[model samples]
Target: MGYALTFEGLRDLAEGAAVLGTGGGGDPYIGRLLVEQQLKAGRTVTIIDAAELPDDALVIPSAMMGAPTVFIEKLPSGAGNIAALRALEAHLGRTAAATMPIECGGLNSMMPLLLGAQLGLPVVDADGMGRAFPELQMETFAVYGVSGSPMAIASDHGDTGIINATDNRRMEWLARAMTIQMGGASYISDYPMDAATVRRTAVPGTLTLARRLGAALRQARAEHADPFQALAAALSGTLYTHGLVLFRGKVTDVDRKTVDGFARGHVTLADLADPRDQLEITFQNEHLVARRNGRVVAIVPDLICTLNSETGTPVTTEALSYGQRLTVFAISTPDLMRTPDALDCFGPTAFGLADPYTPVEHLTAVP
Candidate 1:
């Protein structure tokens, strides 16, 4: 079934997408405002399940490519997304039946909605990554043999370029360089696929999941209940079924830098009760690995999220600072994302970590 996103629902979607983003996707607040502006103008953003898409329909995944830290300061011009999509459509010689998110995290999650509202096209409720990742090549679409090019990119100023790379990895490298030249960030439309391919490769129902996650957190807070508990219950019904609160503490140190078109660094947090008990999280645009007291509690391909300890609001990597109370939560990703082929693309070693990939459930079960 298909439905229109009311203004109220957009808020919850952004909130939930941020949590799933694991502190890497661009600011959801900014993305929310963009979508809200369109909705206020009486435009409707219709969301259809991937299964509802016609087999031959064209779907273009849209997103912002750049460091989330840079995106905070250099706001998009709003025209860039449309420009990219249009350029891609021109190159492909076919109109997009719909636009969809490349990742269901932070700002990227909202980019397709914004585009769909502006273009009056439906937005598919599926995405390449169930969560956000730093690099462009790290997507389920690419993992399942979708080429990243015939891709298009556009800057806030409407500067546009098309990439026709030999491989997805090369496509990312080229796009990253172009993003830097386009002033640290740009809008992109890529991995143009038929609906049948989307059904097979994309993570389905993430948009709905994000909305549900957001509603759960909001409802839990309204009832003065444990938001984490509510979050777990919400996950219990979704494809991402495992959720755990790994640590509760205060930020003690942050070593983040914007380099190579990424927010690369790590954060350290001390147990709220014991200064000696600490958790360290490393990231390259997203939380990739987490260690507590010298033990690996979580690693990539799984979700490592940071949230406000009390309010349960998600905190992005760029927002992490000293002395803020926080909770680090881990959730298991879907089985499709853990296969040997998928691991080859986004495993712990993919991020330069020495540890082997371990399921969050198994890692958390450690005494």
Candidate 2:
């Protein structure tokens, strides 16, 4: 089905990205605004089916990378996105025929939209993973032999780097180091793939799915229904839990320092649903664990999403602070996201937790 993207269509798409982000992908608000701005400026991107891509089409995944907090403080100039893509094109000696989102959650979902509109390339309505994972290598493309290397990163400051790593892990490290130097954020274009590789590796139609999920949530609320329930219903999943958001206050304490080039920090949650139920969440750019009263309630592989209490919007780890009333929502990952290979890429041990991997359903089981 050929679909034209409208403002209303974009809102739904962004909302879907938030849901699929599983609490770690950055917020979609900025991305939404960016795409909207492009559309208003007479720039509307097209979405092409993955099957339509040429067998030799050079495809790249374009996205914004950094702490969402930094994004709000230092707004993007919108140049980094296209710059990265163009740099990748020039480096590989081949022009890209199309662009796709690396992942279709959070800010990343709309990243390619701006570039696609500006360059007049069709945005493939698919992504590497159906949901978001924190690392560059934790993608289906990597598993299926797509080299994230041969990519490029560009900053608004007019700096760019070609990332040619032996593996995706090295690529993540190198990219992280470069982003810190570029002032905590940069736009990257990666996964130089021919259409054949993209077809085999990516979860096609993710963009379309995101739009459907987002629209369902928004429409449910507008019609006086529960948005959470609407989302759960649309995905054939359930809202596992709803708990008080413990952090919403000022930063009473922020012990932050760069480690291996990552902005690492731990924040305390005080004004939570339970006054005596203080919690702490630790992170390395993305939330890794949540502990309530000294017990680990959530960890990697299982999404630990936080949302504003009043609005139920997803919150990025970088945006967490004290005195902000938030509600944490846990949803079961889609079956595709629960693959053993996928879990290994983002398991508890992957984040340095000593415990073995346990499904959220097991944790939530009646004891």
RMSD of each: 0.8, 3.7
Worst 10 residues of 1 by lDDT: 69-78
What tens-digit string does per-residue lDDT give for candidate 1 at 187-277? 9999999999999999999999999999999999999999999999999967898999999999999999998889999999999779999
TM-score of 2: 0.86
Give the residue spans of candidate 2 off by over 4 A.
237-263, 266-274, 277-280, 292-297
Predicted candidate 2 versus true structure: per-residue lDDT over 138-232, tens digit per residue: 78887767789988999998999899998898999899888888988899999889888888888778888788778886787678776556655
Off by over 4 Å in 1: none
| Global CA lDDT computed for model 2 | 0.74
Lowest lDDT 10-residue stretch of candidate 2: 237-246
Residue pairs with backbone overlap in model 1: none
Candidate topping lDDT: 1
